[model samples]
Target: MSRLVLLGLWLVCVLASAVAAIWMLIAVLSGSKRAWRLAVAHDPLANAAFGGNEDETISIRAGKAARAGER
Candidate 1:
C-alpha cells in the first residue's frame, strides 16, 4: 500500500515536470526575441552554486585542504 502510494506520487511529479518543460519550450519557440532572451537568462543563484567558472581553482583548494589534513 505504501509502495503504491509512493509510486503514484512519483508518477504525478514526473508528469508535472514534463508538462512544465513542454510549456516552457512552447513559450520559447513562440515568443518574441526579447521574451526568449529573458527566459534564457541565467539565475544568479545557479551561477553562484556552480562556482561560475570551469577552472582549476576548485581543484587547487581541494588539494590544499588535503595537504593540510596530512600534517
Candidate 2:
C-alpha cells in the first residue's frame, strides 16, 4: 500500500540522519582541536570523568556513614 511505502521512506530517512550524526560525533572526537581540547581539559566534569589532573582526588564513599560526608 502507499502508506507502507511512505513509512519505509520515512524510516530510511531517519536512519540516514542518525548515521550522519554518529559520524559527525566520531569525527569531532578523533580530531585534535582547541575547542575539543578545552572541552575535555577545562571542563571540570570532563576532567573528573577522564582523570585529567593527577593532583586532584575524587573519593566516593557508599552507605550511610559520617566519613562518607567528607567528599
**Which candidate has the highest TM-score of all?**
1
Local accuracy of candidate 1 as per-residue lDDT tens digits, 1-71? 69999999989968975775676677777874554544444343234456644343444545766889941
Give the C-alpha miss distance for residue 70 in model 1, angstroms.
20
For each candidate in turn, give its C-alpha RMSD to the true structure in angstroms: 9.7, 12.6
List the candidates' TM-scores in order.
0.42, 0.40
Model 2 TM-score, all chains together = 0.40
Ten residues in sequence with the least summed lDDT for candidate 2: 57-66
lDDT winner: 1
Q: Backbone clash tally for model 1?
A: 0
Model 1 stretches astray by more than 4 angstroms: 32-71
Which residue pairs show collisions in model 1? none
- Per-residue CA lDDT of candidate 2, range 1-71, in tens? 69999999989968975775566567577773544644443344434556544434232212223365632
> lDDT for model 1, on a 0 to 1 scale?
0.59
Q: Candidate 2: misplaced stretches above 4 Å?
A: 32-71
